[model samples]
Target: MSVWLPTAPCTPRDCAGHLGARRAPLPAAVLLTAGCALTLLGVACVPAVLLLGPAHRDRLIRGWAYAVVRAFGVRVRVTGVTAGEGRSPVGELVVANHVSWLDIPLVATVLPARMLAKSEIRTWPLLGPLAALGGTLFIERDRLRALPGAVRALAGALASGSRVAVFPQGSTWCGRSGGGRFRHAAFQAAVDAGAVVRPVRIRYLTAELHPAGAAAFVGEDPLAASLWRVVTAAGLTAEIRVLPPIPAGSEPDRRALARAAQSAVASDSANRPAESVHH
Candidate 1:
């Protein structure tokens, strides 16, 4: 769970105002704890979901994901479809910008894909086991030597007609001043598997649908503190936009694919409409 924490300083005025807003204004512990408990319950159901077969597993997992977001007091609004509705593009590799931990359930609900995660996520409390069981492919990021194997594993999953998701930025950031550079590793997986590279953008908003500073998990903010910030918000909303898929033919190499996907996400995030949907 030790992701990169940018040492970027907070604006003095922004800090003073945000500090006043930091007071835990609601029963955050109760809500967040309940969310965690329910998510674990979903994890417990995974074995059974698998038994029901892959198609059933996806629907059940999606239902479970939707419930988790409710418990967190966040609403979700989605635009477009992952590879378009009803069209299951084989080897669908979904790539999205990194934001908060909340991004997982938010996006997973839309596309029932296995996540490609850092090995550190396996160390998280209750959520870790759930993620692992939910079909996350853990990469020992510290070991550069393991990249090829990890990429091949991802390719294998994609080749099997299972969708996979990754945060190509490789780290989270405060999206207000723009996002971090997208790394090319995940795109290589797309290339290796000949998968459809789907770019997604995740935005956190307040009840009024404005950007939520409290929701961004930037810097060295502890997980507990981040959870508290989310729980205390009167209400938060996460928007997931599934842009058009980029196939191998569109880009000559991994670098081209990665750069194209990154630009798509950045452009979409910037030009996205202000309208918000509640559900």
Candidate 2:
């Protein structure tokens, strides 16, 4: 198929990425064939610390996340200064671009923040329990009435000095020119909690050093399928850039804050490559 060359995650936004439906499956199959031992090891070691508590569980999860991407042969490079030198923040909302399902583990690998996710994810086979153990806050997306309560919970968490990471985009994207729009709903929590919204940009690179569009779980993709594609994809890298926090107070309201924060992140990543890859 004809497509754009992704050279690396630093590729220009206008660049086109091929939808590798044909190319991803075979490598995914082969990777899975070799992934059994690693998978079993993780399952055996990681879950053992689940009942300990949120802090212990989150740290273990972080270690597991590191093991996971490495096990799958994926490298990660993080840039930008995180608030408080990477320690969790009290009144800060971490807003990031959602590129793929890998964003979750990838982010968690760096900072132990409470993530806001859809309620339905709680029903997914094992992910539900794992996310719960990780202290994830689930929002009832189907019930609009529950939104305020969810926001309230997020605000409460932030006020209580817990770091919260949310994907204002609501869904994943291919990390190309038009990744996706940032919805304003999630921003309310920041306003309510008087927290500054920190914008984070996440991008995926193919093993061949190109932007890996197929790594995104945008459409009707199953969890297993996305995982297979990511692990099987060669030389894949997850680059996360934590932009400076946009002060919510600077904006009049949540909507303006959301727009400003989104633009800030978009402009930062679009303007140039990351300052430098993390060591």
Candidate number of the best TM-score: 1
Range of the 10 consecutive residues with the lowest summed lDDT in candidate 2: 1-10
Residue-level lDDT tens digits of model 2 in 1-279: 111111123221323233433436666566655444544554465447656775676667667776665655567787776423654445778888877767876777666577899888778755566666556899877677787788899989888877788887776666765566677777888888888787888887765656776567665567776666666556667887777778778899988998888888788755755366542
Q: Residue 181: error of model 1 in Å?
A: 1.4
User: Candidate 2: deviation at residue 221, Å?
Assistant: 1.0
Q: Which 10 successive residues of model 1 have the least lDDT summed? A: 12-21
Q: Cα miss at 161, model 1 (Å)? A: 1.2
Residue-pair clashes per prediction, in order, are 0, 3
Model 2 clashing residue pairs (backbone):
7-209, 207-234, 207-235
Q: Which lDDT values do the candidates have, in the order given? A: 0.76, 0.69
Per-model TM-score on C-alpha atoms = 0.88, 0.79
